[model samples]
Every structure is written in structure tokens, then in C-alpha cells.
Target: MTEALLDEAGLVRWGRSLGEVAAREAVFVALSGPLGAGKTRLTQAACAGAGVSEAVTSPTYTLVHWYTGGRGPVAHADLYRIRDASELPGLGWEELETRPGAVFVEWAERAGDELPPDRWEIRFEFAAGGALRRVRVCVRGCAPPIPDPAVYSAAPEAPSC
Candidate 1:
């Protein structure tokens, strides 16, 4: 489940595909990337791919945003301001695992080990040459092997109706 997507369009295509696969697990997705590297863009695309009808926005200032009613609820969180894992539980981190919907966390590196194990680890890479970006998707703990970020494959089955 690893490869290399080229530009914005490629990233969106891959995001949509990944979103479809992610819908099956119904778990959380942690996005790791620097500012302005397209984390929110990919998230929005993924939500759309998951049939999210409402707007998908960055929860920077608010810390979290909730979207429900499409397939199910989607809890989007940006933990950039969080300094320690202790603070997460207060923001519903503990409930994330038990919640009926999926979750998407931005600046997940900040989550540290607090990040749930059974989830997608997505890292965005912006090459030195241009505005084009690359996204790498890997399961947690399977990290070291994914040396560089890659454009992984979708699990094949179409999204659930």
C-alpha cells in the first residue's frame, strides 16, 4: 500500500481513493505536515469522497469540527496547539475511538503516542522544486519501512452504499 503521487490533481485522486478505503475501517486518520502543505485540502477531498455533504474546514482556532449526516459523523481535529497528550482527553480524544463516526487529526505528530494504533498515518511532503506535494500513507507501527512518503494503493472494493 505505497507509491508516489505527482501534483495537486494526483494528490486529490489518491486522497479520494484512500478515503474510500478508510471508510471501511471507520477509524481515525492522522495527518502530519507543515503549514500550507495541503493538509486541509486533502482532508476536504477525502471527506467528499466519503460522501460528506457539509463543508470540511480546518479546526485550527476551534481545535475541532464535527460533520455528520452523510455516511456518519466525521470528527476533524487540529491538535497543533496541544502541548501534551493529557490535554486531549478533555477534547473528546477518549470518545473518538468509541464514537460511531471516523476522525481526522491534523498536526497529529503533536498527538505523540496518544494517537490510536489502528489508523492511517499520512504525511505530506512538499518537494523543493515546486508547489506540488506528495502524501505518504502507512499504517501505524509499520513506519520505519516507509522511508519516504508514497502514494499508496486503495483496497479495491468500492465504497459502501
Candidate 2:
């Protein structure tokens, strides 16, 4: 498990680091957190690190967004509107599972047991009077290693997703 207290900027840095690693191979990431906890922001940063040039936006209404990055394809999905796991298939969850690049699923708790066993689980929470974020990441089953958020360092330019 990895944990960190990150300002919004730090969160972007950490997310990019993880994306850089995930871009090398396929990985499923499950994100769970309250609204405004930066789940979508992290997904955007990860997409950027994977070399996705187009805009990365929360697929709240559409449910899923697909993009091609330098390494491979990237899939970003949101399950907040879903009340149960059974609805995932309607959104082509199976296809997203087999994607060859990084997959980021926001509001993943809604998927319940339908989520893949081998994946990364990330949880976010507001901390320090909502001025910072507390993020926790853990691997499930035999999932590949994830980058350590503690070691992240921000670049000169401000991060935006």
C-alpha cells in the first residue's frame, strides 16, 4: 500500500508517475472517493503521462471515454451514475477490461464484485479542512507494481488535467 497527503498539484505529479508506469503495460485502476476528491483530475493526469494529447474529461454523462496515447489506448470510465454492477455491461465494461493500455475507472465502488481481481485500487479523501487530499493506493491480487506517491516530484509547470 502507498499513501500520501497531497495538494492538488502534488496529486497530479503522483498520478503522472503512476501513468508513466502503466503506459508500459496494461493495468486497471479502480478509483473510489467522494465528489470533488480529485478522481477525475488524477485520471486526466495519468492520461497525459501516457502521452494522450487530447483533452481528458470526466465521462460523467457518457460513462466512458476512449483515447489513443503514444503507448496504446486509454479508457476512462465513471460509474457514479450506475446503481449496480449489472449496468456495467451496458457501458461495455467487458471491452474496457480488455483494453491494451491503462484503464481508469472513477466511482469504482459502484462496480462492486464486477471489478477485475488483479488491479490497482485508489481511494481519495479530503483532508486538512479540505485544502489537501489524502490518497491511498493498494494492489489487489497479483497486480503489477504501482509507482510510489511519496517519491513524486512536481515539474516546473503547473499541472492541470
Candidate 3:
């Protein structure tokens, strides 16, 4: 699925939509984008949609943050600082996938093959004026049904797929 995000609010709305579908067991979400592409912002919103009340911030320095207040456990990881996929093992990458909840990975490309095969990949790119963004979501293996667009008034442009 591909959509156009008019602004940060629209990105958050779309993240919430993804959160609804991600409330399932053992879900993996891979976010790939350049700096300032809104990955962390979307992650925070998705956590909120999943019922998390605590503040969500980028784990860029710490590497990972776990939120259990949501409908289920959510492991948010930032691999931007990691130099190689070999570092994932020490970060509890295995445990995150087997724990029975959702996992969101930012700068996922850095993980290489350490990521699970079944995952949702979201790639973000700057739009014309840099004020907007284009997001593409692709599912690998099995995935839950995407939420209905009618649920969000600020939702992004309809999914291309």
C-alpha cells in the first residue's frame, strides 16, 4: 500500500491505522527512511493508537525501548547507530520477535537479515516541497487486514495496492 502524507498529522493518522492492524501477535514493522523523514513520530503515534499512554521518544541513543502499557508489548528499536547486523543479537532481536507482540524497527535496513521474514515494510520519501511525504507499505508473509480508511479523517491518500 502507498499513500501521500500531507503533513505530520496525516502521518500520525496513518500510523494509527497501522497500529490497529498491528494489535496482533508477533507482528514486525520495518521503517526505512532518511533523517527527518518522520519515522520516530509515526512510531510514537502508532504506540498511542495501541493504547500506550507513556511518552514515546526515539531510542536512537539507547537503541531500544519497550512499551508494555499498550494492548500488548511493543518493542521499538533504532538501528541507525549500529554498524552491522551482528549487533542485533546482543540487542535481544530474537526475543523481540518471539515475545508475542509488535516490534517496530527504525533504519531497518541496517539490520540486514537479522529481521524476521514476516514483516511490514514502510519506506518514506520526501515529496515535492519537503513539506509532504510519500509512504509505501508492503507486507511480507502473512499480515492482518488493514483498518478501514473511513475510521480516520486525516488518513493519507488511499493505499495504492
Candidate 4:
């Protein structure tokens, strides 16, 4: 998938949409964007859509935030303060390769050659007022296994007509 730009609300909507797409294919998202791009907001919206009910925030000091509710241990990482991007593998980066939940990384560009080839690359930027995010959800190499729809289903069915 190529890059597509969107407004702030559109970015949030895109997050929700990406969650839906990953609902069937465990998604490991890497949020790549500058400051004030609404990366955390987008992540929050996506997680909420996927069943998370807690407050999502940046892990600047902590480095990583694991949210468990509906997505089942969704992890969010901010590499902005990372000293050596090559140290990712040692930080359990391999987990995202085969998980159902997403591992959103802000400032993923710092990872350089460390990032896998299949994870989603979400790039966010500042627009006129709010923000604009361009997303490229690609799952070709790492192939993070897709989770069954029933796992993230909200309402379930009312019986087929």
C-alpha cells in the first residue's frame, strides 16, 4: 500500500480503519511522524476501536506502553529518545512480528535498518490547524499473523437473514 494523506479527523478514522483491516491479520503498526502529528491520538482511536478502554499516552520516559483491554496487550513505543536504533532487537522487537495486537512506534525513522519489512508505516505531520497523517500499512515480509475476527469483534451477529 502506498502513502495516503489525511486530515486530523481523517487520520483518526484511518486509524480505526486500519484496526478493522488488522482485525483479521494481527497488525504491528509503526507510527512514523514528527511532533504534533497526533500519533498518540491516532493510536488511542485505533486501540479504542479494537476494544481498548484505557487512556493512551506517549511513553517518552518509559519508552514503551503496553495497553491491555480489547486488543490483548497492545504495545506502543516511542523511539525518539533511542540512543542506538540497532538495539531494537534486544528490546523484544521480535514480538511484534507474530502478534495480534499492534506495536506503534513514534519516530520509527530512527530505527534505520532495524525495522521489519512488513509492518505498517504510519507517517504523521502538521497540517494547517490540526494534523495530517499519511499511512502505509504493509504486511508483506514479517507477515504479522492476522487475528481472527471473533477476537476483536464488538457486537457479534444477530443471526443471518
Q: For each candidate, C-alpha RMSD in Å?
A: 7.1, 5.4, 3.7, 7.8
- Residue clash pairs of candidate 4: 25-146, 26-146, 26-147
lDDT of 2: 0.85
lDDT measured at residue 134 in model 1 versus the true structure, 0 to 100? 59
User: By TM-score, how accurate is candidate 2?
Assistant: 0.91
As a whole number from 0 to 100, the lDDT of residue 58 in candidate 4 is 79
Which residue pairs collide, candidate 1? 3-151
lDDT of 3 by residue, 1-161 (tens): 74444467777887876765675555789999999998898888888877778899899888888887457777889999888798887676777766777888999999898778888888888876787767777778776545433334343356889
Worst 10 residues of 3 by lDDT: 147-156
Error at 145, model 4, angstroms: 12
**TM per candidate:** 0.79, 0.91, 0.86, 0.70
Order of the predicted models by lDDT, top scorer first: 2, 3, 1, 4
Model 4 regions more than 4 Å off: 87-100, 128-161
Off by over 4 Å in 3: 147-161
| Candidate 3 RMSD computed on C-alpha atoms after optimal superposition onto the true structure | 3.7
